[model samples]
Target: MLLHMFFPSKCVTCGSFGKVLCVSCKNSIKPVTQDSCIVCYRNSINGQTHEICKKTSFIDNALAIIKYTGAGRDWIGVIKYKRAYSTISEVVSIFPQSWIQKFKKITQYYTNALIVPIPLHKQREKARGFNQSKKIAKEFSKITNIPTSCVLLRVINTPQQAKQPTKNTRKENIKGAFILKQGQVVKNKTIILIDDLYTSGCTAQEAAKILKIAGAKTVLLFTLAHGKV
Candidate 1:
């Protein structure tokens, strides 16, 4: 009773006063059980790239644990803006265990896999105190035992993709925004690109392009949620 009076629980999605996420609302955030084409954003079998959707220049597979909305979106907002570390942990704990298995299958080619979080500009990271993507990657790394390498760097700080008016503009914004760090070795390796959200697919495509050009065997993108369907 005392705890309830001091810190009342409320549903982040519907504002139902009782819990951070009510049971019904929690069920609304469904885990993605199907594979999706990273480029076309369509349902895929076993997360495989549809032959027609395959392209030489971009990423192969895109994996998201949940569709962006309801509790999933609210949880990501908490991690990104509020920097609530506990909430982040809570959110990740609920991630479908199958997600880890799916990701491992995606990168099975490389004996040594490296996880890379989408980098943030130094200035923006300093202002935010911590990189949310990096945080997510680290937590995920703990769960999967895949080591995270801070190999990717944001050489060009660009505007946030969400603020862009169109998907094309978002792609243009981050076209040349990322590069690998000095002495980074991605050759013949599969890289798991981690991020908080997937919006226009622009950022993932750009980052994957750079990695593939630099000799990465395959680049797979995994985001916590997918925005804009």
Candidate 2:
């Protein structure tokens, strides 16, 4: 707490002192107005997987609070690369109350639900000092009263999805990258997968596939930012 007082907080967007995100920049961040299918990225109700698209993907539905642009992108970058962990709370603070209520309502539909964050490889996570997705998932769970779990582990240290040249390559790279932890049971439970960003979605898809294979009833992904596909 003393550290925070010594170097207070400044708005990431406008450099204003006091708040991590000033009111003006917070209001300026655009929310995803249209829900889309997780598999095809086409129009869908509540970001659910289209019935026809279900055969190709494991995720049941996906949701994101903000588009990955401008201040939203900056906010994620700070938390992810700069280690500005406090920014996570500030970002969550600005989430529209309507969105929070909708998320809470969604959780009500499942009797047994678990919040799971996309896990990073051990080395990467150790070097970074924390898993950004896990941190985000904790905050998410706090708001919704859902429990969080780390049932999936990253066994492969593949190249980053952003560096992959094509979507197919991204998918191939992430294939078989995750495995269920020994003795961890996800059978018959709904999973809410949390992540910092959604770009190609190869990472989330691969993680969800493993959970489904382990008998998870449903896997709903919730990301903080949605990047262009």
Candidate 3:
């Protein structure tokens, strides 16, 4: 990579040269074998919202792949903070094969579906140069055979979720941040919202609520990592 040439990388794990994460370190990041309720993080059927929890939930499921650790976290850190675009590919490459297959089966819920990347505020997106969620969704579409969309726009441009002062503040901050683009065709469709990370699930929830209100049959979420610091 051009960045690697400028400031060569060492493997985050084995300290090998020329890559932020070498092959061995990449192999060490384990897949999430068990799916759980995103709200409670306990075993559940396909990581869907449990009956008790769904009463107050917006998303049908929120499935995150690898744990936010090792090279996984390193990749996210580079992508989020360092603006290292090359690492985005590395992170997406590590999505487990098993999870991809599982996702295929789940999409059977809708004959018509869409992979909606969580959109960014226009100003922030212009500054960042790209929406990482959109990049992830594009690659995710390859395996899941789902078309990706930027229909969910963050019209509000609130403070960054990570910079929010508190969890409650986060919930409120993202409350009206998203609005479905006009004339989008999500009615009666299964919508899978994709993001780079799942922090408190507020952003996903808020986005899902708008989709549900817009008449999506089901709203599911998938993220590269759980922002479990």
Candidate 4:
């Protein structure tokens, strides 16, 4: 309370005084209404990978809360680069109630699910103070009561995907970037990979492939926002 009084929150968009994201700005940002296959970005039921797409993808299902545009993009940038961590919950709070319910149903269906944040290279994380994905995962677990795990390790310090110009380059850069931590058990469990944003999805894909190779029963991705393919 003292902290808030000293440094009051203000909307990242429109510069309103009060909340990190005001209700009006929150409502203006659109939510993803239709689920799409993560691999092909085509309409799919509950964001499941199309059976055909699954042959080439390791992630079984994926979901994102919003599109990466306008206010949505600004919101993510604030949380990511500006380190406005509180904005994460502010963003999630505005999600359509339907999306919240659907997410809960997914957790129920996958009873053996574990929320795993995409790991950051130790050097990067040390500089940033916290992993944005881990923060998002904590929010999800708080709502759903599922456990969170840091089972994946970033063994290679790769360039940020945003800097990679092409999808192929991004894929190549993230390849072999992650490995499961020694003695961590994901076998026969559903791994819910958490990330702040999804673009080419090379980062998530590489992490998911590692989980799948380790015998995870399924791999699902949940992100706060997604950029254009």
Candidate 5:
């Protein structure tokens, strides 16, 4: 295979041959499975389930590929800041496809969802030259054939959540931060909210709430990683 000749098929993090993520590193980024609450994906961290993630919640479901630290953190940082777009293919190829397939089995109610990337404000986008979420969504769409809608826009700029420390501050900071663009594309459509990471789950939750307000039938969140919250 000529393609195989040029690409060594080495692990992105460790430069080992045979796979994009060597089996050892892949095992390191495993998701926590200690009987977590389905809503917040938190495993009773506060001695009681958080009030926000009560059953029959606003946003339908949230799924993340790996816990965001170690190799996962390194990969996300490289992809976002170091222009390692090739790693996107490597990461996506190594994604837990079984987790996704199983989630679809449970959330069959949202059979015809459209993927929507949370948008960046125009100024920030211009500064960064591209939105990473948009790039992820584009690649996801290519692989899955799910339509991606830029129907939501961040009309106002806010302080970056990565810089903010407190969870409450993160939620408050993004309140009234995004707006549905002047288009009828999302109405009556089941929507999949895509993002690079899930910390505190505030951003994805807020985006899902906004899309629901805009008449999206359902909103599900998907992210590449979930950091400690």
Candidate 6:
């Protein structure tokens, strides 16, 4: 077929072009869940949201698609750390149709919601030549017909959350790192936070807190992969 002639249909992970991600690799990745705080979506493994998250009043809900390990980590690392843009489409193509169905179902709960991606510091963004979160948001928007806003501003750069050794350190590292752009109108509207990975979730929680403070009705989080917190 003409489709097979030009594209070669390789796997995203191992370059097996006939299919995107091979079945073996696909089976290797799995989803995980923890008792998450209703406010911050931090793994409430011990119990509910603590005083800190309650103080910030962060996101209302959060969900992640795959556990951030094994094949999941490899996919994220290859795309994010290695800057493999073309891999996104192939990787994206492999998502179960269930995700799209779920996305459509839950998103209907918030009509006319604006999708926002966590922002990157200008210097890092410039150096990387792209914001992976924004790229993912844009791609999701394209499929869902949702509008995306890159209004969340990272006024100052912080150490990457992945490198932070502890949850407490991650919470501190991203504190005061993000601010809603002035004149942005999110008041009374719902927002969906899109990102590539969710580890400690401090970054999304902090960003959502800022949005809520600015009068957003709700901020929900979604990521392609997650790790136990």
| Highest TM-score model number | 4
Q: What is the total number of backbone clashes in candidate 4?
A: 0
Worst 10 residues of 5 by lDDT: 42-51
| lDDT against the true structure, each candidate | 0.77, 0.87, 0.80, 0.89, 0.70, 0.75
Backbone clash count for every predicted candidate, in the order shown: 0, 0, 0, 0, 0, 6
Candidate 6 structure quality by residue, lDDT tens digits, 99-144: 6666666677787599999899999999887888888887777656
Candidate 2: tens digits of C-alpha lDDT, residues 1-229: 9777434488778899977777887778888888788778888888889989989989999989888899888777777765677767777877789988888888888889999999999998988788999989999999889999998999998888888988899999999999999999999999999999988888999999899989999999999888866
Candidate 4: pairs in clash? none
Compose the digit string of candidate 5's lDDT tens values, residues 1-229.
Answer: 7666444376667878876557787666656343244355667531123467645454666666667888888677755654455566566776567655544554455666788898888998887767888888876676566788888888769888888788889989889888888855677888878888877777877787788787888777667776766
The residue pairs that clash in candidate 1, if any, are none
Q: Model 4, 55: alpha-carbon shift in Å?
A: 0.9
What's the TM-score of every candidate structure?
0.85, 0.91, 0.88, 0.92, 0.77, 0.80
| lDDT rank order | 4, 2, 3, 1, 6, 5
Return the lDDT, model 5, position 77.
71
Per-residue lDDT of candidate 1, residues 138-190 (tens digit)? 87687667899989899988988888899788988998999888999898888
Evaluate residue 52 in candidate 4 and report its C-alpha lDDT on the 0 to 100 scale: 97
Give candidate 4 misplaced runs (Cα > 4 Å).
1-10, 16-19
Off by over 4 Å in 1: 1-28, 105-109
Model 2's TM-score against the true structure: 0.91
TM-score-superior candidate, 3 or 4: 4
Clashing pairs in 2: none
Off by over 4 Å in 5: 1-28, 31-39, 43-57, 103-108
Question: Judged by lDDT against the true structure, how good is candidate 4?
Answer: 0.89
* Each prediction's RMSD to truth: 3.7, 2.6, 2.6, 2.6, 5.6, 5.4
lDDT of 5 at 102: 46
Can you tell me which runs of candidate 2 are displaced by over 4 Å?
1-23
